[model samples]
Target: MKYITKNKKNNKQPRTAGEKKIKTMDPALLQVRPAMQESAGFEATLAFSDMPVHQLLKQNIQNKGYRYPTEIQERAIPALLKGADIIGIAATGTGKTGAFLIPFIEQLLHNKNRTGLVVVPTRELAQQVAEEFKALTTGMKFRAACFIGGTNVNADIARAGAKNHLIIATPGRLLDLVNRKALHLNAIEVLILDEFDRMLDMGFINDVTTIASLTRARRQTLLFSATINASQQTLIRQLVQDPLTINVSSGKSASSTVEQNVLEVAPNENKMEVLFNLLSGDSFEKVMLFAETKRTVDNINKQLARRGVRSDVIHGNKSQHYRTKAIQQFKTGHTRVLIATDVASRGLDVQNVTHVINYQLPQTMEAYIHRIGRTGRAGKKGIAYTFIN
Candidate 1:
């Protein structure tokens, strides 16, 4: 007997099938305003001395070659050390990671069992945060477990089962572990939502709400973002208690140190040709190129290879091993050019990135800021080139 299956019409359709859809900013939200200018010839000379940080942490800070703190760090560290829930509004490359890490490390040193949880939007950011924690906690007896996607579940389960003083993770994986009872949030004394805007932009609000609800009610919650929208404000009002608000960015666009320009190309002109022309210049050393899709990134990498351009590509399609290796190669100058999607826009901190080329414009102005932020970091001069067609 032959059996026939009836097709059911579903009202809810998946937004995407195989590849991830590129998120676009609403045009109604796009109004070009004058860039907020910083005071000329005015320098912030704030050192970390006045803060209530522990002596051991101070020693670690000096050892890490950090003498003066960035504006956000200088302001946030004091309150964080005082166990204050804070809402930090700062742009990328503003030492926001250090602002939160130092206080958390100091807190863990006093009480090892008081777990600290940091939820980020991307795996790269998680890895970077973990590295920062390790660097600051050097020679200290503290363990950190990083939970992200595209990794071994059994290994993560084992790591989570171990008594970790610090936990850095992406929302989905952390929520999965929590559901499986492999990780407990009840003992979490500190909860940090880094890049909260990015999390909201990536549609992880539900997961974030669930995870935040699972944590201790009296936890010291810190939410950091480039911009705070209405949704993020609502979340903050619900999650934090009498939060100390700090906005060091002052509504700035990309870094003023970066020379921004646009190249106009005709619709019939091949973007690869334009990119090749740009890469042909000697000044394009240590460049990062941003594309919109994994297929586009791969294609650009392959084309650059054919033309003998030392380039590497990273996106969701590649395994974690390959992605990490590519980033390392790019960081070590083994690869002159790195091609990526928006995945690399946030939480990618590579030094000496001389140029950031937007092969295609990002869907939102905020994303554009992050993509350009990969360069002009650490008070270094860099250039941002955007292609217009």
Candidate 2:
């Protein structure tokens, strides 16, 4: 890739930096590339049947077409089955959901009445966890309630009263239901916070804490996040007891399979036009454009639509129905591009995404990683570009 700079033009890959503050328009910083390294490794001697889980779970695993356990699943399932508190750090698409679900399902099979709760950062994530739980417990007699915002409160209340073995919920709606006496979590045996750090990022820490406190009988607390900040040390301690930290992705990094680069927007150049020209390329199929705010996403969607490009937008401002429909349209290839704010960074999972473009630089590196991770999933080669204007 070539870059245009104020001083001169070049075709060099920029050196990676360790900046405390981002320098978005630095001419010397032409491209931002992630250092490639093996994520992590473990002895994979056990198959689904070899693990000491129920036969039904083995069958379910096979039915899902999961041939082998990912690193997190392999390391977490054993300890979790023993009812141990754990802090799991793995990248996106590493099977973190299955790691917790498989063991917890085994726990449910042994004792049918015991209930568990999974708290996530987004409504979409809560829905996904519930769906994963359903798939894992296909033949088993397990029941679950999913409570999220942008849905009918009365419906969640009715479902909450139905003797469920598990509850998957987003923190705000979950806590609201608890305060309204619609949901009872006092006797819950296990509590899981998926995308744990993202909850902190979204300012849902207090809500999650209150929900965790309400689940007073939680014997095992499982925390999973793709990236962990050292500043969250105190919060992590409060969540888990004598926790085992598992770093399957080693530390903070983007996917190795993603080809990371940057686009230089010259002082006089029109960035929107530059993006339009880039997307016009034959290689730019099925792209995700990440903008800083809802208004920006919507503007981009409008611009793309006017230029005869099929696209959809999702953000916190959109209702659940709108966001769900937008994602479905993008996922099904009905839309060639999906424009989004940070809300879709964690929970949005679409397969075979050809490219991810950061129209605006993310506030933090962790957010950047989550944004690019939407592509390069399931061991597929993908591309990510950050536009430097």
Query: Highest TM-score: which candidate?
Result: 2
Worst 10 residues of 2 by lDDT: 11-20
| RMSD of each candidate relative to the true structure | 10.0, 4.9
Error of 1 at 153 (Å): 0.4
| The best candidate in terms of lDDT | 2
Q: Which pairs clash (backbone N, Cα, C closer than 3 Å) in model 1?
A: none
Clashes of each: 0, 0
Output the TM-score of candidate 2.
0.90
Could you tell me every candidate's TM-score relative to the true structure? 0.89, 0.90
Candidate 2, lDDT over the whole model: 0.83
- How far residue 36's Cα lies from its native spot in candidate 2, in Å, is 5.0
Clashing pairs for predicted structure model 2, backbone only: none
Q: Can you write out model 1's per-residue Cα lDDT over 39-101, one digit (the tens) per residue?
A: 361245666665677787888888878888887888898799889999998777778999999
Candidate 2 deviant stretches above 4 angstroms: 1-32, 35-43
